[model samples]
Target: MAAEMSLVSVVLFIATGALVFFLLFLFAKRQIMRFALRSARKPHINIGADAPRELREEIQRRLTIVQSVRFEPTLLSEQVLEASKSVPNHYLHRMKALDAFTNAVDCLRSKDTTIGLRGTKQTMQLYLFTLCPSAANSSQAQIIDMFCSSYNHARHHPANFGNAELTNYMELLDKVIRMIKDNKKRRAAALYPAVETEVRLRRDCGKRESAETVRHTGKSNNLRLQARRNQPAASRPEHVEQFNMVDKSSGYSSTDHSSSGRGSVERLISPQHSFKPERDEAV
Candidate 1:
């Protein structure tokens, strides 16, 4: 279907063998993308070990919020994977994205800094993304320029950090991450209908029909064709002769021949023998 996933974490699975399609909604994709944009910008707060120990710790703690915001809580059972094996590449892509989300979250949780300090890369990005995501949807150059602009503004204006208190920041982070987790759960639930429907469709589309079943189905069709008639056998209509098949041995069809009425039949058989093609069988 060529459905784009760049707009959101909407991973679409276009069918290859049958009429079916599905999507995987990973909330992490958007955050991960914005994170990349923020990272690509040259200027960001990098509190090295030589910097004040307190400042480094604070920065590390705040980093956890960024990672948490990017976390994806989508964990499907093996059944979903097996049921959707037809699109292995897309399934694998979703798994890879999930893994990336996990790793990002882990790295951030290992941090000791609090969130929202002047000149912090992730702080401004997260706040901006949460409030205005269109800024990150631009080209790489534009996104980098936007990040640089935000960084310079925050560097001079400490209030630009959004929130700096440890408890308030954690609470706000918790709310944002909770919403993200809930959204992911809803997306995960949506997978069930697609998986179940595709599996059922595969069965209904007769992909697993046995050769015997196919033969039997064809036989039944032939029988139905045989029993069907243009008119009642007892009251056969004269016009019916136009549609009847001709005997090839006569070197002519029942129509477009000089013979009229039963003469056409006599061409295929002796006049002494009456034609009796109509038959019925107890189905």
Candidate 2:
């Protein structure tokens, strides 16, 4: 009996310990979830080094206002209506909102069409893109449908949005912004090598062309000089006058031995017979 009683007590203790441990686990899970939610809800602040201070401040201010605007838990939450009412009808605020929206869209590397879209239209476009990137290639009708549906839902069915819908959208926007910046960096990196290679190729080509030009010019100049050197001196204009004067001075005289003088002049003019061969074999 003592042994049975001890066994029962051990079982009870084990069960009690398990229940306590289960409760602690639940508590820990709850705390972890809460912390995660809080962290997600918190806004991240970053000022662009490239952006002007005023522009950065304006963006921050607008984002702050957007974060402050929270949807209610109920599906019938008039979140937009409430925000509209709470915020004054000041043109400055409207302008700020528009500016912030445009700037953020620009940051995302969006097309001119997307950037041109105003207010809720732009939001819908981005949201649709986030959901289905291929939707960008969809037909005009399909695109129109998506835009109309999003507009209708946001305007008429505020209750359909989750409590953290606005926050989620904001997060998505931030993610897209980062993605665009990363894409630009990657493209720039990829293009740098190509640009450098092209520049190097062009430089090499230019050098080759210049070298070839110089080589061709030198060859042509050398050929011209060789031609000039190979030219007959008698054909030269400078020696023509001297040849004429020699001819006039050495002209045949009837009083002298005309035949002999003519023969001598002919021999002087013709180098082929500079040395005459013996007509008779040693008389």
Candidate 3:
């Protein structure tokens, strides 16, 4: 009886130990499965869409404000030396502004919806401000004209565009204008004769071109007037007659004549006079 009891106790102990081991194994498996599930169920990173509407609008507003603040041509000329000295260092600031403008434009273009009128105007203003010269004085106009020509070349010509930089666009303009102004200041200097000669040549060329354009415009306008006049009074459309009458009323006179056996006509008109009648009639 004593031996049988001892054997029974030993069997019970072995069974208890086996049960504990099984429970531990089950717990470990459950924990491993939970860890794997957690690892597999991670959240994704979010890279949101383009700039928000509010931010874009704010940028556009700022751009408009910047555009309206016109630079004074006389002040710019007076401070040319100072601008030259500061430009190299402050170039990065200008570049940052340019980048902001570019990014804003990109955001504006990305949307399928039409930008509001205000937004469109602001964008155009920003583009002009960043890319065009300030409209302050006649000097500024000349600088702007040159800058525009350069910009067109840059856009169309790969070599020119490659050499172009934001700083180059901004600073070079001021530099060239300053150099011209400085040359004018030193007109009595030893280099004055050569510089004056170049200036005179440029001035003459500009005047000649302007005169040619005026002559061509006048000839074309005269031809148009003559054709309208030659139209039989019955064939003269009401609008054409009205237009001619308005032109005559507003200081524009048309003369029909014959030159070298060819019918020649002349029309003397001012743009202001031509447009004013139409505007007044509309109003």
Candidate 4:
């Protein structure tokens, strides 16, 4: 009986341990799922406020206002009324237009769905129209209008724009702004004649150097050719006449005979012997 009771106790202990493990596993799984859901709902935040110093300086330089009129902050607002005579109306109109556009874009990002969509579409259309206004109908305006319509449709149908879609749109907008700034920089560069002149001078100097190098190379080749022509040819041995003289007296050696031959011939053959016969010459 005691053995049977021990066995039953062992089975109960095992069952309790398994139940505890299963409960812990369930709790862990729930925590993991909650973390995943929270991560999915979180908005992406751009980190780090420090931008490259060069980029900041470039932005400041480009945005520097070019104004002939100076006014104090305290009295500027009131002075503006009096200064209206000097200030161009067109300039004021442009400022007001830019302000309106900025405000419209900000309003489009509001929490109210209907107002946000309507404001966004209207702001987009306004920006397009201002950029390109045509009596016939501007292509830029038409494109913006189409994009606005599509955005409105997408907003109403949430499935049309998931997280990826919104991310892509933001990326595209960033690229467009970057391209616009680049184009503005290029246009500014084009307007500066001093910069262009410096570039031209640098190019001209490079070309001049290349021409001088070519001229020097040609001169060197000509000098080398002239030097080759002025050089002398190899010297050859001098030619000497050979004469065969047989010696009747064996007392003289060949070297002695060779050396004495000229003197002996000169003594034996006189100017008179040339006109006389061989026997007379012998006598």
lDDT tens per residue, model 3, 1-283? 9999999999999999999999999999999988887787543432222679887777667866985564311112225434644674323333322333333333333541222223334433233322222232223333444444454443334442322344334333333323332333232232223321111222464475322221111111133323533556575333222212212112211122224321111111112111111111222
What's the lDDT for all of these models? 0.35, 0.40, 0.36, 0.36
For residue 37, model 1's alpha carbon misses the true position, in angstroms, by 28
Return whichever of 1 and 3 wins on TM-score.
3
Clashes of each: 10, 1, 0, 0
lDDT of 4 by residue, 164-189 (tens): 34333332232222222223333333
Candidate 4 has what TM-score? 0.21
Off by over 4 Å in 1: 1-104, 107-164, 189-283
Residues 1-283, model 1: lDDT tens digits = 3345543333322342123321223446667877987888544545555788888888788876774554334444456546545653323323322333333334333441222222334544444333222222322213323333433433343432332222222222222232332233333332323321111223336566433221111111222222322325454323322211323234223233443443222232222222222232234
On the 0 to 100 scale, the lDDT of residue 73 in model 1 is 48
Expressed as tens digits, the lDDT of each residue in 1-283 for candidate 2 is 9999999999999999999999999999999988887788454435554699999888778877884464322121245435545783322222222233334554333432222223333444444343333223223213323333433444455444332333223223333333333334333432333221111222364465322221111111133223434656574333122212212334232223465534222322223212222132242
TM-scores for all predictions: 0.17, 0.21, 0.20, 0.21
Clashing pairs in 4: none
- The lDDT leader among the candidates is 2
- Please report, as a residue range, the 10-residue window in candidate 3 with the lowest summed lDDT: 262-271
